[model samples]
Target: MSSPDVPSMTGVHVVVMGVSGSGKSTVAAALAERLTLPFGEGDEFHGERNRALMAAGVPLTDADRAPWLLAVRDWMSAQAPTGSVVACSALRRAYRDVLRGALGDVLFLEVDVPAAVLRARMSARTEHFMPVSLLDSQLATLEPLAADEPGARVDGSASPAAVVEACLAAVRLRCDA
Candidate 1:
């Protein structure tokens, strides 16, 4: 469990989560850079088959997502002692639970954004394997952070800098508690 102290002083671990194009990577990387913590991109942990399935516009089933989620969770667990920030879709409560169990009470930074904005961002990106077509399924699968969760929901419609600032403020407040 994280102590109620400044995260930077206490080595807090955070997961920046959202559907594809919600700016999870951008905001998480910025936040990590600001906090001087190690950063990991969730997509990079996907297996070739998973990436291929997503690239083909197929929505991943829970069965298909399990291994990848466990990988991300393990990475987060490994980073815990040193503190880190990770960008993961973490679209379901079960997924977040896996992470929580691994990290033992980590903070989740949900990058909540409008559907239109998400579509626009997905359309603009060309290098990522996730197609805009899968956004609906992703959204459908997404379970927003609950009130009891140890984290904050951030507005992803804002600039990345703004989003990172908001995340920092929210996490700091949580840490201060």
Candidate 2:
């Protein structure tokens, strides 16, 4: 069945989350453009140590990710007045919780894709420090949103435009509700 339509958001913080190569950035950018909200890429918040670890094909531990998540949370909290869209892996429940605590009206937009699709995307992508080797670990660490989680899931297999549309629809619905 097709996904349900979502209403538009007035002032909300949208967190686009998924493993690497799941098109989080592309979808988040489009959603930001559509909503006219400021956008922040979670990668940009990564500490130098974390960047080096990922660049060396090492997966980050929860400890390694905590500071980064905190940075993103702080950024979100700071942007509360204007609203924002942030692209973050948010692979674990704790990480997501941290963000939620900081940004009270937080909403997650999860981009779901198969391992093979993610691998292919990672292989084809360039200029990103995250390597394909880390994908497996990322998948392992990912804590998908539970049924009661405040978010919408979108198929990452679709075109970027389609994914963006789905996210926008979901955000709108949440806002209207």
Candidate 3:
């Protein structure tokens, strides 16, 4: 994925984190492409009960998400040897910890998109289980990465290309550091 000038990501798992409709999946998939790593769609790891709850405009509690989070974490852990990129909401610090603690090095990319933009995106999208009504719940649950965490926050409102470049640049900076 990297040339001589750029450092190869030998042991870094990138977790694209954000609230629903924040472009976590889009940015994550693109970032994986640029890094030539395997992609894990976090939503695919959710259980039927969780999906039904979200589809019904119900916000998932921590208990509701625990197993699903663990599933995603374990998948990334398995891929830790080769490293990989995954898309997940990872709304809480604890949830992020559950993921990164299992892997040696993890970069959590928090995609920041405005509430209005998030609502618009969620309302317009039909293929996802998440409803716009749950947007506020997700936003309220989100905890930004702390200074001690290995990650960067990128604006998701930008075009996909710009967002991907920003993500790559963030990865470069974090990986180089």
Residue 119, model 3: Cα distance from true site in angstroms: 0.7
Model 3: C-alpha RMSD to truth? 1.2
Clashing pairs in 3: none
Candidate 1 ranges beyond 4 A from true positions: 1-6, 9-11
Taking all chains together, the TM-score of candidate 1 against the true structure is 0.94
Top-TM-score structure, candidate number? 3
Candidate 2, 6-44: lDDT as tens digits: 344434689999999999998998888777778999999
Clashes (backbone N, CA, C under 3 Å), per candidate, total 0, 5, 0
Report the Cα RMSD per candidate. Answer: 2.9, 3.9, 1.2
TM-score of 3: 0.96
Candidate 3 per-residue C-alpha lDDT over 1-177 given as tens digits, one digit per residue, 9 for 90 to 100: 466544577667899999999998999999898888889999999999999999998999999999998999889888877788999999999999899865658899999999999999888998889989999999899999888888989999999889988999998888877
State how far residue 86 of model 3 sits from its true place (Å). Answer: 0.4
Q: After superposition, how far is residue 51 of candidate 1 from its true place, in Å?
A: 0.2
Scanning candidate 2 in windows of ten residues, the lowest lDDT window is 1-10
Alpha-carbon lDDT, every model: 0.88, 0.88, 0.89
TM-score of each: 0.94, 0.93, 0.96
